[model samples]
Target: MFLLIRISQQLINGLSIGSIYALIAIGYSLIYSILMFSNFAHSSFLLMGAYTGFYILILLSSSFPLSLLIAMLGSGILAVLIEKIAYKPIRDRGNPTLYFIIASMGISIFFENFIICTIGPRFRSYPRIMQTTFVELGKLNISVMDIYAAVVAIAFLLMLSYLIEKTKVGIAIRAASFDLEVVGLMGVNTNMLISIVFLIAGILAGLAGEFLGVKYTVYPQLGYITNKAYIAAVFGGLGNLKGAVLGSILLGLLEALITGFLSSAMRDIFVFCLLILVLLIKPSGLMGIQKQDKV
Candidate 1:
């Protein structure tokens, strides 16, 4: 019974953490699918979202839901602006892919430093918006925050799936992923489509930032931890939504198990090892495509 309880506890913990990874991975996958390059600046949007949500809760109201909404909107707008300011000019000039990557990296560094200079390097804990009590199930104690995070993550992913699968804009997004040049040639406003994609990615990033802040604490370097989500994206299959989700959950479970049964310090080593193994065995990722077929 004790062993079973331990296992269940790890599973719940994994699910909670994995859900956040999945959220961030979705954004990464979306941008990579269309842009054909990793936008390191995604870290900026996420960190900004965390700080934005934190201030909203502290200054405006302690309403968690309201903070989430505003954070999502704020980050979404920021993402669009970034695309316009940094990425758009390069794209218009038909510059090499390296320029986009360097720009993103610059943006990331700028945001991190800006936060440090403006807010300092100290960590800020979120307000106790939700009770920390646990709900027991047959000797297993489940955290309420874990359940809430998992539920909200799942709900948002579902909504994203629906938008991608059912809506016209979603169809355009899918088409753009396959061939942005072709989509534009087909009369679709490729620029608008790209902005919308960034918007969706920003919204997901905002949710992830806030949830992560609640689970841990808000800090300038929070974006560094998002590297795990990037790894999850590679593990599941870069540019594949389903794969990103699966990879994140699996990585989360693996991390939880390692922390539960092994040393916490070994957790990161194993994660990178797993990533290496995945790349060696299947570079396309567990759920990613191996051909020109795009998600």
Candidate 2:
């Protein structure tokens, strides 16, 4: 009974965290599908989302939902800005990979420090409006926040899936996903689509940031936490949204179980060990079957 309870709790935690990672993975995959490897600044955008909400709440005294909307929109705008200024020119150049990756790292570093400068070097919680409630379920303890986070993330996932599968924009993203150059040649206004994809990616990261900030706490260096999700993204396949989400959920569950069974300190190491093992066995990731091409 104890083990079962432990597993249930861990599973819930994992799903929650994994879903957040999946959000980031979506950001990575969307850009990857379009521009191929233009997603390194994603984590920084998440930080920006949290900070965006932090200040919007302080400045306007807004409610949680409203604050979140502002944050997501703010971050989405920033995502577009980053693409235009930081990534647009460097894309597809001879040294695009090296230059862009470094630029992304620079963005990440700048945000990490910028958060420190703006919010100070301590952990901060969102406004009380974002606080979650707890509920009891037949000896199984559940929190309203957990349910809310899971539901919102899942809903976003569904919306994203629908967007990719149903609408005209979905058709474009799908087409671009398969063969961006050809789609562009077919007169799809590929640049506009790419910009929209970055904006969408930003919104997703902003939502994930809100999830992290409200459920946990907002810190200046919060993007560091999403590193595990980065690993999951790579493990699942860089350009594969389904793979990234699946891997994130799996890793989230695994980490939660480790934390429950052992100690928190061991959870990170344990997860990486498992990840390495997975890579060793599966190589291209459990779902990285798309296969990178060689020049």
Candidate 3:
């Protein structure tokens, strides 16, 4: 009975945590799709969103959902501006891809340091979260907040998928992802596409941040979780949206199982090992498409 209880707890814990990772991972995947570069600074936006949400929720007398909306918009606008000021110049120079990656790291460092300087180095707890203990089945237990996180994450992804699949903007996005020049020739505003993509990424990061704020506390270094999201995205498939989602779920389940049998301290290490092994065996990821290079 004790073992079963432990397993249940682990599974619940993993799903809840994994849902947050998946939320951020989807942002990582989408930005990669539009920008053709992996952004390190996007991670820092998670920190920004969480901190801002905390202030909005606790200090400003706003509700949780309202706080999330405002925070997401804030982050999204920041992302668009960052793309215009930082990435646009880099893209214009036709420099090597390595340069952009380095710049991304630089941006990440800037945001992180800025947060540290501005907010100090303490964790801030949520002001007014609705906490509940929910029990299900004869021998299972769960939290309402966990269910809320999972549902919100899943719904947002679906909405994104729909936008990408069923809208003109999405088509433009898809075209730009494949070849910006071609899309440009087709009269698509590449600049607009890039801005929108960054905006979308920012919004998703906010979702992750809100959950993290509730699950733990607001910290200036919340970008640390972005690393996990990036890993999950890569593990699933870098540019594949569906792949990133599945990868998050897979990592979540794996972490839960490991934590069940082993120690929580070893959970991340175990998952990283699994990621490495999976990459070694199948680099394309579970649902990623491989592009063919002509000889």
The candidate maximizing lDDT is 1
| TM-score of candidate 1 versus the correct structure, residues matched by position | 0.96
Error of 1 at 169 (Å): 0.8
Instruction: Give the distance in Å from residue 222's predicted Cα in candidate 1 to where it truly belongs.
Output: 1.0
Query: lDDT tens digits, residues 1-295, model 3?
Result: 9788877787887778788888888888888876667888887678768877888987888888899898888788888888888888988988877777898899999888887787788878887475655757667777777888888888998899999999999888887778778898888888888899989999989778877888778877778888887888999999888888888878888888887798889988898888888888888777777767548
User: Per-residue lDDT for 144-261 in model 2, tens only?
Assistant: 8778878888898899999988999989998998888889899898778988999999999998888788888888668876677778887787677788898888888888888888
Roughly what TM-score does model 2 have, to 2 decimal places? 0.93
Candidate 1 on 94-179: residue-level lDDT in tens?
A: 99889999999999999999999999999999898664778888887777887898899999999999999999999999999888
Candidate 1 lDDT (Cα, 0 to 1): 0.91
Q: Compute the lDDT for candidate 3.
A: 0.83
- What is the lDDT, from 0 to 100, of the residue 41 in candidate 1? 89
Arranged by lDDT with the best first, the candidates are 1, 3, 2
The per-prediction tally of clashing pairs is: 0, 0, 0
Which segments of model 1 are wrong by more than 4 Å? 292-295
Cα lDDT, all candidates: 0.91, 0.82, 0.83
Which portions of model 2 miss their true places by more than 4 Å? 92-94, 130-132, 292-295
C-alpha TM-score for every candidate? 0.96, 0.93, 0.94
